[model samples]
Target: MNDQYELLDSGNGKKLERYGDIILDRPCAQAVWAPRNPGLWETATASFDRVGGLNWEGRSKVSKAWNVEIAGVVMKLSATDFGHIGVFPETRSLWQWIRSALREQAQTKGRELKFLNLFAYSGGATLAAAQAGAQCCHLDASKGMVEWARENAKLNGLQDAPIRWIVDDVIKFLRREVKRGNRYDGILLDPPSFGRGKKGELYKIEDQLMTTLDLVHEVLSEDPAFVLLTSHTPGFSPIVLGNLLRQYHQSGTFECGEMLLTGKPGVNELPNGNWACWINTFS
Candidate 1:
């Protein structure tokens, strides 16, 4: 699998990265240190910052949309006002792990596994799970993002795959799934620190994450495969995520780590987020 994403260098609250043929300089709040490859930053085709609230420089240098293959999944990338491209490169490792876990579970159970992804931006994890032969449900609050994910699925020749693309509030959707007795063998979620739902329902991670996890637990099938939770919010460390999952699961093998943006030989690996996962032990 050819990964088209690379973090060339990062420091001084910014990260320089290459996505396919375009190089972008984006804000990285955690990169407080000096950049290692100072000279490499000059190659950035475009840059985004929040100095006066969300701004992009040299945007005309790049196309509006392009394709990038990361972790064997094809994604459509476009620069957004929020300083995010359609895909997040840090989750590449998580996508690979999801594929492996789902494949193992399907083989062991001799049945197709069901997977669910919440707050699924651009459907990278969903596509990975589908590629591993899992029936997937991809949900997000933004209709535009859901459509972008569908486009990505088409880009990967998975338009006809067993994927349920949904645009709804995460909490409301999960509740409906629970009521419908719909359960998944594996679940992946990347919740935002704060956001509004489809009906203007406010979601603050500090206030509602536990409730969200409780609802997620209700929708999980018995003898499940795994649960992966990742976050980019500051102060939400690996241990914080692991502890949150531990509250709902007691028997699984738990692991947590910093999600990194990795590059070639000399480039520094930047910790872009944190992830925690609980994997079931099958006999």
Candidate 2:
């Protein structure tokens, strides 16, 4: 199966993707009843045999590995959950927000900052913050994902760096950090649509987000760089996310909007996901 979805050409029933040394010819759910390209179909590096699973076709020569590069940050990608790329390309927009917040905070505060990334996945935002002059603690519930994040850090030559890789449930970790009086100046959260924590700490974004937002609010110092919330959940709107931030943090100029993908008008010209940004403008 193609670990990274390199949409070589996508239309009607299938998407052609170049994954590492192999090409992928697969059916897409979104391509309902589209034309079938038999010629292009034969050139697949691999193909997922079904929906939401990574089964392959063709003589796949490489291991199941993928990488996404954005703004000089390299993210080693893989499917940690059902069929999800831990660091999806749609998330580049969120990384930009993280970079913007950190850069602005560094200039104004005249010092570095500490960053907290919850549900960090493969460290796309962590790499961005660390390279932007923030000491970041990357947290996730999956050990494999934490390892993937660590590999990405090293892929960018950031191994042995001051970054802390914590493999734990996000809520539990945050609670302990709060109790220890530890705080962060910059925070990034990319919650799932609906899932359970390692210890089964129920997480339904629509139901649990408001409370989590309030929890995250308490962990932020009075003077924070920025707070970002990115949700790929189909039902959660960016405005609602911003509303939650406003309700909880009450400080800072809160602005929430979708992360727009910048590209030409044809293939990749759409905002893939939503992001809400809150800058503590209380200077």
Candidate 3:
């Protein structure tokens, strides 16, 4: 992770972070622990105030938009209507894994890889895969997010990369891909706990993820390079995702772990999410 993206302090139902020199304080329900540095929280450049809706407070040096680099890929960040800042720093590990896999495949077999990234916000994983020389299909339900992703791609000099930006519901797209017999070497999806599709289709991960994964299985290549499933929803264990991978194939290596951010001086690791991944080596 870049120094620009750091968890300065986290605790007491909130977290203080630095994004390219701008410090922010935001609500983090997972930070049930006490703060190690209360002074850092008080001096935050801006803080999120979630009253009825959401708003930012305090003196701010940051603009409405900014840029941050991760593994040499530049991403445009912004404080949007949603409480979240545009970029998701927690996904850095997943991006690096995708890049490394592509590089390894190139060295070992010189094979061209294709990836499907669902809910690929701001092109983080999409750019990483493309930067590693893979064709990618980036899917998201939000048109605004897709546009933001395009901007990020351009920022990283990947505007002409082999990336298909699609704005559609994930389940619908996966079903269509199965109908069209479209297959991808790698599949990655970061499902939200609760969300709504373009046409107002509701998605509740707890209720719908298994069915979505079943559909995803239909579109995976016979010799898929990998499948990555990550979630931040409380109570959803990584083992649950590992078990889901069993439905995809008879035998494969599965790994599950927590994706954490190395916090500053006092705090060591701040839990961001949990992940389950499978690697298929046989053709």
Specify the highest-TM-score model's number: 1
What is the C-alpha local distance difference test score of each model? 0.92, 0.71, 0.84
Clashes of 1: 0
Q: Tell me the deviation in Å of residue 153 in model 1.
A: 0.3
Question: Which structure among the candidates has the greatest lDDT?
Answer: 1
User: Considering lDDT, which of the candidate structures 1 and 3 is the better prediction for this target?
Assistant: 1
Better of 1 and 2 by lDDT: 1
Model 1 ranges off by over 4 Å = none
Q: Write down the TM-score of every candidate.
A: 0.98, 0.82, 0.94
lDDT tens readout by residue for model 2, 40-98: 66666556555555555443443456665665577664432243445565576566667
Over the full model, what C-alpha lDDT does candidate 3 score relative to the true structure? 0.84
Which lDDT tens digits does candidate 1 get at residues 1-283? 7888888999999999999999999989889999998999999999999997889999998898989999999999998778788988899999999999899889998899999999998999999999999999999998889999999999999999999999889999989998999999999989999988888889999998988999999998987998999999999999999999999876869999999999998887899899999988853
- Rank by TM-score, highest first: 1, 3, 2
Clashes of each: 0, 6, 0
RMSD of each: 1.0, 4.1, 1.7
Report lDDT (Cα) of residue 211, candidate 3.
81
Evaluation by TM-score, superior candidate among 1 and 2: 1
